[model samples]
Target: QLDDDLVSALKGALSGSLEALILGLMKSTAQYDASELKASMKGLGTDEETLIEIVCSRNNEELAEIKRVYRDMFKKDLEKDVAGDTSGNFAKLLLALVQTRRDEPSNVVDYEKIDEDARALYEAGVKRKGTDVVTWIEIMSQRSVPHLQKVFERYKSYSPYDMKESIRKEVKGDLEKSFLTLVECFENRQLYFASRLNEAMKSKGAKEKVVTRIIVSRCEVDLIKIRTEFKKHFKRSLYQTITEHTKGDYQKALLSLCGGDD
Candidate 1:
């Protein structure tokens, strides 16, 4: 940590240039996410799905930073805002996710535990008449990614269909969508992004916001893999798809981030 003298000196230096100070503050990814989250909640209709997706997908470290950033930027608690805006089981799930308490990814995998969870999932959803959403939520939310990977792999053997297809058949509404997204992302984030990009492009009028968000968010992380997945799954390059679907400065900016295809 900086000493008080250095801190004061740095603050004084930054205070002299308003533009520089603003730019420096805007450079933080956590702050950017916090700002976006706040904006999503500000409108006449809340972007509830986006809020849930972001909170659920982010791991403990990222969510902790997000909470700090949210407080710094909004002078309000993220959890409280979420609670005020949402209700019922969905709200509870989002609240649980924002706690940032997912089990850390584990290298060691227990085959028996995986089998048990897989069986539990099958019994909770498909094997019975009514679905056990609480069981599904608890299992999906609490498990490590590695463990979930194994659980999904083992689930196929226990069930007639793949996990995604099973989820499609067994679950419905927002919970279903969230679980499917989580399963897809845990299996392959790049492919999930490619699918999102494809959906954005294929829809009527195009989903520019989704496309921009994915490209900007993943450009530094795995845009190359996303491009590859786009090609592999869709039989067309992400660049070509973006070129066809978007126009003007937005298209150019997204293309620059997309770079080249596989």
Candidate 2:
């Protein structure tokens, strides 16, 4: 009771700006993610990659918090902004993700449902004349991770090809990439981050922004796993990649977060 009273008194005493900073310091990961997303989209040219990374990486609960914090910080609906800034299937995918309506995780894996969903995807893509993008979007957006994992596994046996190959054969352009990234994240989030880091570092001139975003955002989450995946996939340490690609305080900071190369 006394602690609550003292906190209230401090809140009353402190300036709004100071209080806001203090609050920000105490904000949750979802809130921080929301703020980062808002900043990425606020400028003249949108940071589309950042927007996609954030939206695709977060789960339904985290996305709900992001939506709330985004509205509080920007005074604009995130969905509307995303719609306005992006177009076509990419926009659709982002909007679907922002809905935060995916199924809750379940301990029991429903094989029947997985087989059905896998067949749905197969019919929508490889088995059809044209891709049934809506079916893909709906399933990808709504299904739980465990459910999707089963779906992908079932897809391999149900069809002659892997899910990624099916996607590759069916769609082209940013939409295809978006769906593939979603699948990758669902399968293994740490590997997805590792892949993004590799892409950022490998790109010409190097995407410093992407590198910074991944390292900063993931440092507290599964960065250790990401580092291991990086080494496994790339055969080079993420720390070494950062060291070779970046210089000065920037390199030092990234290496510090990486906690040395494996």
Report clash pairs, candidate 2.
none
Q: lDDT tens digits, residues 1-262, model 1? A: 3454664565666542232233333335676567667877885778866675567666677789999989987899999988887776677677777877678887777888899999998888888998787877778878888899899988888889788888899877766677788888789878988998899888997776667656655666678988998999999999999889877656666677688655
Q: Which stretches of candidate 2 lie over 4 Å from their true place?
A: 1-28, 43-45
Candidate 1 Cα deviation (angstroms), residue 25:
12
Q: What C-alpha lDDT do the candidate models reach, one value each?
A: 0.76, 0.81
Worst lDDT run of 10 residues, candidate 2, spans 16-25
Question: Which RMSD does model 1 reach against the true structure?
Answer: 6.6
Each prediction's number of clashing residue pairs: 0, 0
Worst 10 residues of 1 by lDDT: 16-25
How much does candidate 2 score in TM-score?
Answer: 0.84
TM-score of each: 0.83, 0.84
Cα lDDT of model 2 by residue, 1-262, tens digit: 8755765776787643334333333445666687777777776887766787888888887788788888887788889988988888888888999997799989998888998999999998888899888899999999999899989999987778898888888888767777788889999888999999998888887787677667766777779999999999999999899888777655766788788779
